[model samples]
Target chain A: MTPPPSATRPGAAALGLAGLLGLLLTVEVLPRSGVVSADYLPPTSRIVRALAVELNDRAFWRALGDTLTGWALGLAIAVVAGVVAGVLIGSVPFLRAATASTIEFLRPIPSVALIPLAVLLFGTGLGSTLLLVVYAAFWQVLVQVLYGIQDVDPVTRDTARSYNLGTWARVRHVLWPTALPYVMTGVRLAASVALILAITAELVIGSPGLGSRIAVAQTSQAVPEMYALIMIAGLLGLLINLAARTVERRALFWHQSVRGEAVL
Target chain B: MLDVRGLRKIYGGHGREVEALRDLTFTLDPGELVCLVGPSGCGKTTLLKCVAGLLAPTSGEVLLDGSPVTGPRPGMAVVFQEYSRSLFPWMRVRDNVELPLRQKKSLGRQRRHALVEDALEAVGLTASAGAYPWQLSGGMQQRVAIARALAYEPEVLLMDEPFAAVDAQTRAGLEDLVRKLWQERGMTILFVTHDIDEAVYLGQRVLTLSASPTVVQDELKITLPHERDQLESRADARFAELRTHVYAQIRAAGTRPAPTA
Candidate 1:
């Protein structure tokens, strides 16, 4: 929900930034000095120039849009489905008991294990990427939502019931507050997972995204352009993480875990 | 106004049956302030839960205004021991108090606001009405819970060791607050506690319960003046005598072996 306290410490960000710059310098020196062949690993300067060139290309922007569309759509579907399923299953004791074994059994299978099935069903398109992305992210949310519902205190539940609050009211006020922090936790994890699955689907299935562009560059022996596309993917993941954390902190400002982060 | 007739609660089944209450019978007339005193584990909580309609009895029933209570209804309200758990930390004190009233649909927005303000004023928490429960001290949090219950305006109020978690100083203040509220509101109150002095100090009649499988062992009537100062009432000879009697009953109950049903 929050960045580590070490990151918040005075001058820690500056020191981290310096460390990143140092790594960049080392890479620049290693490749230019031929310690690693330039063809295999381009120097930092060449990668940056290529990144600037790619930014000017309309094809690069389109690929970025396609990748983001897959991640966002998959994450949205997963969140809504997971929360509905989690709450419905959790609140009903009989339902929870009946489904417990099935959930446990299905949760651990890797999403990529279904890559063959995804390609067979939807071919090399956004649909193929979406299948993998949604599958990878749905369990992250469902498991956390279950944990949140279980964490609701018995006394609090009794308080709501004692007040004669109707079932819907109880869910809105009591259950929602207790489960929200966990749902945010689930979303954050899912966001990252969704991105990974999206790129993996595109690379393996030859879908139109940054991942496919990188593959094209690799096959064509355009080392600098390939590195540039990989950098763009890293930047996209970083931006998504930042957005997720911000949403979590804002939605859960009342929670203890997020309240402490506010002071920092 | 409140009647608990032949209440019995049995937990578990087969190999691990626990008969917490053999039978508990009591009545609180309108505006009656009765204290239920028992040993630490004498199923006081179980009894209170059943009376509040939060738990079903193994046998017998709780009646409010002569109607059977199958579950929590608008005519009844309860204050729990764990105030921190009872109050929603996500809501401010005012919202916490207003929540129950909001369910009443009959109350307009202005009326609901006024009731919330009045409850907060009664509990002397008007200034902290804007603060979250977690931001307040332990005693203040309990006051918020009391306000929430008060705002609901139940005809019969059930308090389950409501002051048990507070310190002695805070407990005395809360006891006086409760006394004032009962006198002002005229609601039938059944307060369950283990403290002998508190039982004697607060109740018109104190009922002492025996160990599990529990039953009412003794009843003592307190003859204190209507208007009482905590220090003066506590020092009175009659208060001492009544508390001693309840104390002895509790001690005996603690040592007595469970009888075979």
Candidate 2:
């Protein structure tokens, strides 16, 4: 039973790796062979060497750390604010209705569009980057948590009430468990959104991070280094996504969606 | 003792008014088991919800121990039909049973543990104490629900068609378990079901309810012996007579026309 799927996984990985290598080879050859100018598009080998050099550079490490710090801080703030607000708003019908139009009006406004206001208010600092990141990520978590609270079974709510559970006890025992899966999903989405906004703020608002470093490299015409920084940002996004999924799966092991995967 | 005096529940207002229960009245003495049987769409559930204080009646009131019920009273527990929904899926069997006790804040840790153990033992689910509700079968899940109610040590236990979702064999086993538990605990139980045979076999006095906008049509006393086996008690002549009588009452109520303005 296990052998067939396990065997197919390696086969699938080999195919994927083969495809990735093929694309890398195409990019490697295209510029060097003069199909595209080397000045505009650096060879994969040059980019790889630049990446190796950047990995050893102290300044590169500092910039990477700064970017991650901004992202982590923004995500933490958003999660706390979103969960609290979502629970409060979702539990009360009057509050939910009152805020529905306001939430709708505010939610769809892109965080990048707030970059000008953030720059005007805080200038090019961690605050500016966090403003956009938190704004974007907060909506992700808030919407998911709202959906989660609404999804709570009426029977379960009635059971809690009939048991004479206090407000805090009911929230902890019934509401929290019911809303957790949604919170996790929100966190997963917010994690990526936070990272994207953090980078965007650094790039556009001239904040001190990897995105700013990429901007500086581009301005200095260090094409290989610029490509290397972009690649690193992509890799970081991938790692954050993987980490978020692992956390979600671990936290929601009791949930049907997670448990159903195990059965298969 | 519990008294439901002229209980009326009207959902919505004015033109959209849906009358679920109209002039429903019944009384239960301490340590007595009564079953409420009715048609499919009857207000049996609404009645139980009112008595449980989960919902307020539009008119009249439920008096528990001579106090008019305003909210969920401390000495009452309910086992709903949807056992899967009622039991917290995240908690283990023992934890689920211990929840109400923890909410009450009267029992210490050791006492709570002892009660959980006793309740699980009574339901013959001591072995599955560490398991989750979803991990158990439907019948076992319902047993966990009953165990939770038992651990509460309520003066009144209201069951709302609790065994309706399980298989026939499982339902019969659950029925017997309820009877055994009722006999042992001697707590006032109000069991609601649409199954005539189940009402006849379980209740000391079976209350037959009319169709939609329900009112108590008849109440029949069962004189069967306390010591009952599933086969012998159900096969008894008195059981058949009471079952037939309740069936006729329900049938007549179902065919009856709605009252004109």
Predicted candidate 2, C-alpha RMSD: 2.5
> Lowest-lDDT window of 10 residues in candidate 2 chain A?
A1-10
**Candidate 1 DockQ score?**
0.57
Model 1 ranges with Cα > 4 A deviation: A1-4, A261-264, B258-261
* Candidate 2 ranges beyond 4 A from true positions: A1-12, A261-264, B258-261
TM-score of 2: 0.94
Candidate 1 interface RMSD, angstroms, 1 decimal: 3.6
Error of 1 at B229 (Å): 1.3
Pairs in clash, predicted candidate 1:
none
lDDT of residue A63 for candidate 1: 95
lDDT of 2 by residue, B1-261 (tens): 999999999899566999888888899999999999999999888899999999999999999999998899888999999998999988988999998898767689999999999999999999999987888889999999999999999999999999999999999999999999998999999999999999998999999999988888899998899877789998999888889999999999899954421
lDDT of 1 by residue, B40-140 (tens): 88899999889888999999998888999898989888999999899997898899999888899999999999999999999999999888888787888
